[model samples]
Target: MGTFRDAMSYPLLRVGLIMLILALLISIAGFYRVNKTYSASGTLGEGMHYLGDDKFENEYLYHNRTLVLYSSNANLSLLQGAEMTNYTLVDREITLHPEERPVIYVFNGSVNYTYNATAVDYPYAVYSLFAFVLMLVGVVMAFLGYTQFLRDVKEGKK
Candidate 1:
């Protein structure tokens, strides 16, 4: 149809297609990086972002120049302004309990702290979520552009 033909030249449709491609690339890269785990061993000083009530909920740690999250049910009072020496950080999947969900483990030469994810993989989930949103926006934009172009063609404007 002439309407469909005219719609092919819609500028917004082209922009939406480009965004869709970019979103796909981002999602693929995010997935690849999120699955990969890592480990590090060093001395960590102090904990930030403490979320707990009586019992320990979660906290952020700076390990090896990377910000990571460590969580536990018990009150890890030692993490407050205390330097954790000879600490070993192990990512999920290769942890002692491989069957459990994705998480990171921190062994402070004495106590063990479990984290939701590693610094390398944690932020990728947010990136992937953003990519998904981009994909949705692209789809909507492409559809709107095509329809608008078709409407213009119907009115003999194209």
Candidate 2:
């Protein structure tokens, strides 16, 4: 307790503590966001109905300027002139049926559009993983700093 108190008095230790706290908070928030997005996206996907027509309009919304489209059917195609850029297609095995496995189309686009299909899970998952890693690093660093401070205190007292 004395060592901890002395460590807390140091400016560097204080800054490290603040950083650790912030990292923990960010990681928690990121995880919560990811969980919420997954639940919401699952609900949306379950409720989604297949459009009989090839042409459809949909909207994707997120804090960042990006959109994701998910569909079980591989026969679908995005119409031209949607102004989408850097599009990438990823195969996601969320469904039991191989043929109905979800294909995710990710790209940067405005949230103000209608689409036939859309997904909101992938981006949040990615963000959550990143934050989790950051939190792990911060925790390790804080622990090491605390131990080092304790060692220094013991040496000085000797």
Candidate 3:
């Protein structure tokens, strides 16, 4: 349509379109990046052992038939050692797959045990949220730009 073509001549509209494209690409990357790993849930106090200070004052260990996990905190010993509290652990492939001693730890669930784990040095959900916000902003900006273009054309300023 002529109206669409005319609006495409607007500079702000072009910038907004570029922003939208970038946001889409970023969101796709985030989606695949998130799917590359998985999460596991379990009770904290079941089969966990207090390692009694290997590198820190409070260190613990958990293991199953397939994987081994070691968690440490300055105050981890304060919690009940064998209480039936729930927890979640992410896949080791996401944390440090290439290293000889890849770090494995438990995370958010029914327990307050905080594990400062990293996925390539950054959190995936936070970055994905930022990309989503960016996409929303881009959409709003594009709408505004199209409306401004229409107004300018109506006022014979285009």
Candidate 4:
């Protein structure tokens, strides 16, 4: 009991709290930017249309569903699922819901591609699910590091 309270007496705990809040704020910012209404500029290279193996066959669309990138604080991975109703002049932005997670489907006649997403009941793809778990681990590590630093300071016999 005394040790835990003593650990909280250091200033680093305050710093940790600030950092944790900052992380959450940054997460919210990212969530907002991605969920905004679709714009023409953002759509130009995001998706492409292609015909089946034979040009005369039916056409299919390929979307850039995901990208995994690292940031200063954490690794950020994005899986975008779009629902397109019309072929030309696409209308209504399609979003991949958490429930859909990862689905097996052919994109632009490519069978190797897969759909992986975040916040799903069941994660169908390995990479998509790994990223989310990574983020959660990072959060836990940050808290542990912060608290550890504070504990070390409070225990110093100065």
Candidate 5:
């Protein structure tokens, strides 16, 4: 405990604590942004086409009706539990029937596809989780540093 107190008295330790707080705030913001992007849904089709955000590398398409070919730049991969299709990708679009398959599109860059189906964006979810872990570590470090600093101040008065 004494050694920790001595180490926390340094000016660098205070700076580290401040940085940790900032990290926590940033992680929270990131989580909110991910949820917002994923929850927002709109129509994409002949009349109303949906354009993918440049920041996102993947999007999920969900529905239980007709399957239609829409234009997109991303590679479509059927997610697990989704109906398998032998449809070929041609002219940047492929038509599926019965809408029984849930497809997840993977893109090297950003993508813009017709959005006749519900879209779920989660390209940044992993990044958000990573940030959350970092924030947790930062909080623990800051708490220890602050506690030691307080102890040192009390001892100095004695």
Candidate 6:
């Protein structure tokens, strides 16, 4: 296709593709990492997303320099550290046991170490980060190419 062929000519397009793949990988790794660290093994059913709707059916991945998962059960509260620490309940929801009060705890830790992903999919943060970087690169490359093309044209006239 002409569109596809045209896209391949630009280095920005290539970089964009690479960034896309990297973002996906990071998201997967983030989910896996969250699952591993999270004792709440209960299937979130349709993963996690910013908008807790069908449109956002995906795995939940903690983000930020630090994450906090609220829970009272000693095991659930502890992620990296075992010692009992002060935790506050941010939110609550339904679980397997109806009678069981939804537990919550502050799971504070570095996302980098906690998540198995290069960049935890914290709100699709990974994709956004890479996309921004790719955009910056693309701008620079376009400017360079345009300037060079203009220079070449001027030289030919002389």
Instruction: Give Cα-based local distance difference scores for all models.
Output: 0.48, 0.40, 0.46, 0.34, 0.46, 0.36
**In model 3, which residue pairs have backbone atoms overlapping below 3 Å?**
none
| Candidate 4 local lDDT, 1-158, one digit each (tens) | 24555555555554455555665555544433122111111111223422112221112122223311111222112222563322212222233232222222222221222223222121223344444554565566557756676556678741
lDDT tens digits, residues 4-75, model 3? 778888877877887899888877766443211223333344333332223322121221112223333211
**How many clashes does the backbone of model 6 have?**
11
Candidate 2's C-alpha runs over 4 A off are: 1-3, 10-15, 31-123
What's model 1's TM-score? 0.41
* Candidate 6 CA-lDDT value: 0.36
Deviating ranges (above 4 Å) for candidate 4: 3-6, 34-158
Better of 1 and 5 by lDDT: 1
Q: Rank the candidates by lDDT, best first.
A: 1, 5, 3, 2, 6, 4
* Clashes, model 5: 2
Q: What shift in Å separates residue 138 of candidate 5 from its native position after superposition? A: 1.2
lDDT (10s digit) by residue, model 5, range 13-56: 66566667777666656544222222223333222223334233
Candidate 1, residue 148: the lDDT equals: 81
- TM-score, cand. 3: 0.41
TM-score of 2: 0.37
Tens digit per residue, CA lDDT, model 1, 88-114: 333311123221122223333223333
TM-score of each: 0.41, 0.37, 0.41, 0.25, 0.39, 0.26
Q: What global local distance difference test value does model 1 have?
A: 0.48
Better of 3 and 5 by lDDT: 5
| Regions of candidate 3 where Cα sits further than 4 Å from its true position | 34-124, 155-158
- Residue 87 of model 2 has an lDDT of 28
* Better candidate number, 4 or 5, judged by lDDT: 5
lDDT of 5 at 23: 70
